[model samples]
Target: MKVVSSRDFNQDVSHAKRAARIEPIFITDRGRPTHVLMSIENFRHLTGQTETIVDLLAMPEPRDIDLDGSRPTTWDRQAKFG
Candidate 1:
């Protein structure tokens, strides 16, 4: 992981771009982390969106997912409901 202050990042954008390939580059503001820069491959891996259901599920159903119940409704005493 590489960290870069916003100033240096702006000064040397190329180095930051190259650093993003190996790992993520953390951009900080006032010593606090502001943003992260990562390679597209790493981003995909981190988000887990690239994996197919079959690949993620592996064996069988991971969990029993169902939505058989109807949507619930909430009403306030001052509000009308039909």
Candidate 2:
């Protein structure tokens, strides 16, 4: 793990990101830990999230969609629900 001050993190974001690829980077504010930087893969593994954005985007489009636009009649609206 690497520790970086907020000022240093802001000044060189690329360096923090590079270090995150290998391990978690702890960002501190006023000598107190505030945030953590890590690769997306590590985050997903830690959170147990398996689906990626790419997987969601690659899903097949719905083939059958009900587009009926008819409005309910007054009698239909008055029907009781069990």
Candidate 3:
């Protein structure tokens, strides 16, 4: 990773960002690391480690739905009594 002083960061931000693509760029303040600049793709790939709701829905259902309607369902039986 490349390290840039806070003062240099403002003057050479474009170069610093280009360098960050290969790895991370550390922004230093008084010789101490303060922040990091990374590529969006890398950031998303690292943060998108969990399964989203859309991904879960795209998968198959857990079990059969029993959509036959041939069996006497609750509504069918209730109508006879009521």
Each candidate structure's TM-score, on Cα atoms with residue i matched to residue i, is 0.58, 0.64, 0.55
Task: For candidate 2, give the lDDT of residue 18.
Answer: 94
Report model 2's TM-score to 2 decimal places: 0.64
Which pairs of residues have clashing backbones in candidate 1? none
Off by over 4 Å in 1: 51-82
Sort order, TM-score high to low:
2, 1, 3
Candidate 1 lowest-lDDT run of ten? 69-78
Tell me, by lDDT, which candidate is best: 2
lDDT (tens digit, per residue) of candidate 2 on 8-70: 999999999999999999999999999999998899999999988897899998987546846
Candidate 3 lDDT at 13 equals 88
The predicted structure with the larger lDDT, 2 or 3, is 2
Q: How does residue 5 of candidate 2 score in lDDT?
A: 100
Residue 45, model 2: lDDT of: 92
Q: After superposition, how far is residue 82 of candidate 1 from its true place, in Å?
A: 73
Report the lDDT tens digits of candidate 1 across residue range 1-82: 7889999999999999899999999999989899999887898888876856776678576476546755346546565553
Compute the lDDT of residue 57 as modeled in candidate 2: 96
Worst 10 residues of 2 by lDDT: 73-82
Clashing pairs in 2: none
